[model samples]
Target: MSSFRVMRCQPLAREAGSVKKPLNHLLVSAFVYAGLGVASGLFYREFTKLNGFPEGAFTQLGLAHTHLLSLGFFPFLILLGLERAFTFSASRKRFGWFLGLYHAGVILTSAMLIVHGCLTVLGLESSAMISGIAGLGHMAITAAIIVLFLALRTAVRGVERPAAVAA
Candidate 1:
């Protein structure tokens, strides 16, 4: 009897508010990521000659640029499109966590990669520290991807249930 009551309560609790808001947040985040990518690239080009083609500088900048564009920009865009195409629920917490992780990963990784790379080129930091920062950035990105996937999957499942019919 208690099990049945708990089971009944679970479904009711899950059936909450609209999930559109989170999806919109993801879309906006994607656009911002795209813009960031472009800005980074432009800066790289402008500063490359002035900074000199120091070892690892170009490589780091290129890695940061690619990650920003591919992971940061495209993932959110794809999420938004998926939400629209599948009509997924827009659970705010679900989407919020995903966006938060995504943005945090991008910002941290990009910043570290750029700064460490530049510092390395300028002969400020040792190679090991730069490598460590890059590794941390990569881990952040991986965590963000996991969060996005889980949120998307959950939202899609939520929307697949049949709507209650009126008598």
Candidate 2:
């Protein structure tokens, strides 16, 4: 009976460390990205209207809204689902690295978009430096993707398959 209780508790103990904390972080990140996305949309509309930006004028503002939603908000939500299946927190260090690099990339990219958009709306020419910084952000995002896959691979390999049921 003691051994039976220990066997049942083992999985529960592992789960306490591996799932709840990381899932909470992902949930918080998702909501944050959602708020930022909405704010960016509002900022684009108002800032452009105040500047009398022409309807057909090209701007990065619109792209920023979509990018935040798609890249930032949606990815976190998707990771939440993946966490359930793969237990990504199993590789905690790699997961931490991924979170750091990914968030940095998203923030840098979105900030540059806002800056470039504001400059364009105000009839100012953007510098090559802005473009260079944005490129670095993309590179960081790419690196994070590689890190995520590495972490996922580790988690997947660690999962144990159940024995086949008797026919």
TM-score of each: 0.70, 0.90
Query: How well does candidate 1 score on lDDT at residue 74?
Result: 85
lDDT of 2 by residue, 1-167 (tens): 22322221111126465578999999999999999999999999999999899987889977899889998999999999888777877787899999999999999999999999999999999999999999888999999999999998877777766544444
User: What's the TM for model 2?
Assistant: 0.90
Q: What are the lDDT figures for the candidates, one per model?
A: 0.65, 0.86
TM-score of 1: 0.70
The collision pairs in model 1 are 19-90, 19-91, 20-90
Which whole-number lDDT from 0 to 100 does residue 83 have in model 2? 84
Worst ten-residue run, lDDT, model 2?
Answer: 4-13
Q: Over the stretch 1-167, how does candidate 1's per-residue lDDT look in tens digits?
A: 22322211111123223545656677788888899999887766656657776534444665667778987888777777776655433455655665566577678888877776566456575567656766776776677667667766765566544444444
